[model samples]
Target: MPRIKTILMAGTALASVLVLTPSPAAAQSTTKPKAEEQQEAETSTAKADRETLLDTITISATMINEAVFDSLSATSYVGDKDLERIQANTPADIFKTTPGVGASMNGDDPATAINIRGLQQYGRVVVTLDGARQDYWRVGHGSGSFYIEPDLLKAVTVIRGPVSNAYGSGGIGGLVAFETKDAGDFLNADEQYAISEKIAYESNGEGFTTSTTAAIRPHQAFDIIGNVNWRDRDAYEDGHGDEVRWTGEEVTSGYGKATFRPAQGHEIKLGAIIQRYEDYVTGSSGSTSATLSRYDADTINNTYTAKYTYFDPDDRLLDYAFTAYHNKTKAEQTQVWPTSSIGNFRYYDVRTTGISGHNSSRFDWMGLAHTLTYGGDYYYLEGESSASHFGQGEAQAYGGFLQWMGHYSSWLELIAAIRYDGYHLDGETKGTTTTPPEDESLDGDQVSPRFTVGVTPFTGFQLFGGYSEGYRAPGLQDVFRGSGAHDTADGYIPNFGLKPEVAKSWEGGVNLKYDGILTESDILRGKFTGFYTKVYDYIETDFTITPRMTDNIGTARLQGVEAELIYDLGWGFINLTGALIDAELIDTDNPKYKGQPLENAPLDKFSATVGFRAFEDQLIFGGQYLAVGEVKRTQRSSGTNPGQVDGPAQYSDAFELVNLFANWIVSENLKIDLAVENLFDVAYTDPQSAWSYTSDVEQGKGRTFKIGVTTRFGG
Candidate 1:
């Protein structure tokens, strides 16, 4: 009876969505009659043509918004069109098309870990949603991970290195920032209200997704938007027709935001998001026990943010912003042990609160135009767990930064920045029969510096280079978390004296933007870059010791080259991306693991795609091919160490995959999308997934067909 009622309610909602929608003709007829319509149409088309030739603007690399072509560091932007083509359901799905990035999926929870330039875990990479930090970490057997529903994202931007120290601390690897949809994304210039609905399904997991959005502009000064989504999925089958356990999940999310413009040059935004996930996993965050316990888990994430901005074209000194945010994540698990005599329930929770203020000041000095940016921030993070064997702790960070951009001429630009970051940690341990009880505290601070120079040597060609230093402070999990102990004497131990990690990085790159190279309508945009990074006081567990313990493992280095190219032939587009990375532990205290390859680094990767637009830009089709090189396992420094350490590293072979997608706009009010992943049904494993302690290889998702439809009304 409950299932029946659910089905009935779903049917009613769908019916309401369709019935409330306005006709295509009504939506298009915004002005009275056909008067002035032709002029408006011509203006819109001209605006689009101009925008197509202009560079994309992004702010993830720095607090100030500027063109990507002008950026001093490597940056990638994912807009709405890219998300639609991939039929992205999770953050992992979207990142498959992005270069220099990888996602690790552990167990059933769809949220994946973000890896940039072969570095991840322990705050090395910072992930933010609408300027609020997504600092959820389980300290599990795999990488540190967080979850965010893709339906709420309007755009995603990535910075590949630590050139952006002004944003915050602990982003030595990079940063991924997600922007939520706003009222302007849906509402038409002349419309007062708008509604949009979307539905999607996938064949592999038999997943179904439904989402609805509403936007309203009640007055000239105020606007608001609201969104809700629901999804259900089952375990998916691999390429070999085998089911992957714990690969399914149920999710629901809600978001709402409002913007107010009280007066010219003043704006205020308030927003909130709530999401929940229900799934099953095998073990706790810090341990993968041999007992093979099954846990039914419920996870929740909630975030709220408020931002105020003041900007005026005539006032160069008042381009300023202030923001405050709070985020919370909770995970509850009910464990079912093989020995049914005992059952256990545990929970892990983390909360983060932060505030930031910044401003950009523009001035002219010595015949050069300059923009100076300065900012400061404070964040307080706390976490706790219910399990007796798990450790709990808290931390606080305060930081400030200053940056200066000098444009001597149209051909030469220079940038310099410095940041001071300080953090303090309070760690606690709950002792068991086999473990000791203790409480400890630690604190550290660092000053990071960066410099860059960009020059337009010739028309349509630009060259840039930079050097930077990144710093990451130890978090609670890295210092307090412990692996459970059994009857054996080799149980994991906690480390109270962990040191912070520091990275020195350098990069040189060339960007080319050429139009009319082949024909009047032809266009090409290309970027090629080479980067090297060395990390000091790298942190790793001392696996060679009995009952592994954390320690500073000396130094590690990664050097790589990345290339991207896109060409438009008036009717279609072709794109290519390639990367080659060498990562190793160059120096370490453990003699057994020195000069070994990193556990989850792929040496080489390449991908290519081609797409065409036809039928007056109403229909589009595209296909992509991806190839990855083999990854080597971490080896002991010497062969004389005791054998059989817990969760030894393993290697994976090279693999290739193919995908195809198509999109059609049936009418002004409706659109459809289709995608087929792993088109050849090839059996492969991703390096990120290979980190599972239980298996040497985790099978990647196989061939799957996805279809989606979107409808808009009352705009």
Candidate 2:
């Protein structure tokens, strides 16, 4: 066990060092201010040009949004135009085409899990929606993001490694934030009252996908947006297209948003969201049409938010953002119990309300550019779970964060961030608190810090190094899961006391850009980057094989690497990306199978994609390929994984697949698109539970297709 754990830690450390290094230009941007610092951006923000691989995107790689790149250890951006090109139904779809990115089903569920640096799902990677921290812990999906309609999004930025201080905790890998539509540039001029709408429908036969969005910005001060979605799929098939018999899901959602800027340097936004998912599940082996799955759950997520922002006097570099919101998540799940007569059930109702405020100030100190950001947040969540026993859990978390950025010219930059968070949980089980010896109240606090330096010597060339620490507070289930839910352990049980897990990671990488690099005639633009991260308290869970009780087996170590590359030649574009992760339990201090791969961590995974566009951008085409490495599972005292760890460790052998898609212009007012997933159908099982031994996971959708169209009236 010790040896295996050591390898996991060592592998991760090495990966962190091997990720692409930073460049000279990035270093300068961090430490110094340029002469034309507040100059109008001429880097191409044209809406009619249709942004492609050749365009450069400016991001808040540091505390303040800037035009500089290569100032951070790992980060990637997807623009509005790019989102349209993908014709995606969900946010997860975009990850599929991004380099060094991975997206898979959490199970046979609608909540598709996303991974970066091989660490994701749960709250490992912080996800912010329009700057609001969205915790994935409300149960279903169990990640940082919920089901947000894709069309309403304007951009998605991924800080692929632990290099920022924008989170309170659980940013072990990095962070991904989704920014909804904001039309500052789109409606900046009086004559710019034009509308861009999209309506798309897609179906691979595995199910049907459809969505429509309406956005209007009659003036720069206000933008109104709304979206709707519907999906349905019958039982899916295997790689051979033969019906797998009994796997299906149905979902529908609607949303609305409004942004208002009544005065200069100030803005306010409000939004409403609602979604419900229903599953008509049929078990794997076709047992009684619906009795097979140990997990048959239906969930709903409803949210509302109001936000305000203040820009500096010049709106040139300084900004402050504040937001407050409320969200509710509820679910009911059926568990197949041991006794035929006794049916087991699990239900949870969770409500969360919180407020967050961030203030960032940017200025030029002497010849150097300086930006400082600080913020704090508070959230109270009330939840209840029921089974053989019902338990109510209330947890409140509060924290503050700070970040400082120093630029030494456009070639070098530095940043430091720190955050402290405290959590308290007070609650009791339904019947006898004394039976489980309920302590009644638990309190803990964690501190996380990050440091990064970036250097950029030339345009599009960057090098960066970063150090960061992250942690996750124990969830209600981790410390309170009962015996009836257990399958492989000694009758299910729960531990009232559990500690938070932590990780300290460091990464150094280089970023390269190719635009007008090879020849003046070349229109291709490309970027390549690599990174690594290491965690100390890589949290893990244990279950008894016979009784099915969950246990926290202390802490472990985890490490992984990530890489992405893309190229565009006007005529076509190509992208390649991959991830490698290694994890194991350390100091198990137990005799039950000492050395084994940590549950749910795949040793290696990667993907490849290519896209083409016809003359005048009237036609578009693309395809994708993916790979999932084999995994090793440990024997179980207990686990939700139906297959014992010893069994094949369920080698979800790596497989290859292809996807094809296209878009055609119908007229000035309308357009059409066609997308096919799994063009060359490949049989593959994606890992789901953190406890699953065999990884008898969700199967990839076989041959799905979608057709969609959009039309618009005068703005």
Candidate 3:
């Protein structure tokens, strides 16, 4: 508590000093000539055209809309053009080149789990669609997963690390914000309506996808958009030309949005999304044994949202936005393999409802341009499972935050924020003869603070640094799980007294933006970041004792460096991204096992992409190369029995892949795309995948060819 108070005080004091400082630019602001200002605006527009990447604005980092390149924290943006160029088939594909980000997915399941800076699962990383949180969890051999169709999204913004604490609670690792497509994305300014149809096919999986989108502007104040997509795929062969079982599935999804403008400054948007998946999944996600359990699974997800905003240039005090949303995810499975459990049914469901609102007021304070923002958010989650060992529970979280952003002399900027978060969890566990049924509950609260400063010492370069804190409450499963036979050697004991995890992070970075560096029409933009984070009360499963239980393990330290760079000339572009990370678990009761590398940590990765435009920008082609480092892990033997081998050491070999893509604009209403993935047909496994085991790492898809065609028309 004292530490929290000290941080708050320091932040407030720093903000005051920065805002009160006088600057020459502020005093001379009114003296700038109109002709010079106009020239500056034109120069900005010309620069935007030259930069092929990160041309979009991002609102996830500081809640203030700004270009990703200008953000002080490590942030990445994927716009509609990037999405179209990638032709992503899964959520993982969308982030292939993003630094410090890794995704793990089971071979048979469409769900995905994201890892950031070696931290993942149980709300360490927050995923949101249209500002609605996706809270779904199921007990398995790997990390928890979420479902989202990449086709429905128009943009994705990623904010890495706890600097995003103001966005919400429990995002100690990072935040991934997804923005769905709307009427504005498809309809032109002068068009009243429009329709688009797209069809795509893949060779390796024999996959096919059909999509249709329609947008209409019935009145000057109202607009509506709808889209439907269906996709099907067969089991795909690996590089060895052997089929990977349960790798195929069918998916259907639909989305709709209606926007209303009742007043000049007020707007409202109502949206709905639905997705259904049918496939065969395995009981043990990563296991390679032939006798592993198999199940026929059907999953459905739905989300509804309403958002309202009021923004008027004349009213600086009323730049306000509010959103309310509800989401539900349900899955049904029937055991089909493993004779003993054949015909058994399992069901899982989770419902999340949340509301968030914020208002920003801008004004000049003490010769500085300042913005003060305040907001509060609340969310409730309920989950239930038919599996005996999986617990049923309810959880609620609420938080409020206040932030101040100040700018001086067009060269210096400062940001300070404080947030308070509280959570309550309650659940019941199935008990055995040795342990009676018990109802458990827990509650906790914390205050976290953040501060950042940036200085542009030169015209095209900036140096920035910040310190932030984040909090994550324990999950319901961690507190309520209590189903095990006490007499048996294999059992899990429930620990209701578990503590929440807290993260303190420090980050520094440099941003570079230059135009006409080498040629008359060339651009270069890049950001390099280094970060270190220490987590207190890190939670993990403890196997040192009989009746293994979940507990607060100890402190964890993670440090890493990430880099992203893009260079664009008129005819061609080059993009590069890479990350190097090191992490360890420390302060453990067992000294011999201390300082071991954390399990499931992603390996070092680097990517490079080069592309060229031809035929007056109508034809575009590109190729990408990715390299991943190797990882090796040795399982620790049981403490009770010394020198006993628990399992073989896990190892994943280093690998490289190359891909090529092309897009051709045939006419105003027609376009075509082609891509080849894994061009060399390399046989390798992703390091952090659920199917990556010591004996047999799941083989990635072999060389695959994809093609798509789209036609659009409007009246």
lDDT per residue for candidate 3 within 609-634, as digits (tens), equals 89999886799899998878777665
User: Candidate 2 overall Cα lDDT vs. reference?
Assistant: 0.59
lDDT of 1 at 705: 95
Q: lDDT (CA) for every model shown?
A: 0.77, 0.59, 0.82
The candidate that achieves the highest TM-score relative to the unseen native structure: 3
- Backbone clash pairs for candidate 1 read 140-285, 491-547, 591-637, 592-636, 592-637, 592-638, 593-637
lDDT digits (tens) for residues 198-231 of candidate 1: 9999999898999999999989799999999999
Candidate 3 clashing pairs? none
Error of 3 at 613 (Å): 0.6
Candidate 2, 108-212: lDDT as tens digits: 455545566556654666666666555544332222235555655778887765554454455665677777665453443443344545544444434555666
- Candidate 3 TM-score to native: 0.91
Off by over 4 Å in 1: 1-54, 284-291, 337-342, 388-390, 429-438, 485-490, 635-649, 691-698
Structural similarity to truth (TM-score) of each candidate: 0.89, 0.81, 0.91
Q: lDDT winner between 2 and 3, please give it.
A: 3
Among these predicted structures, which one has the highest lDDT?
3
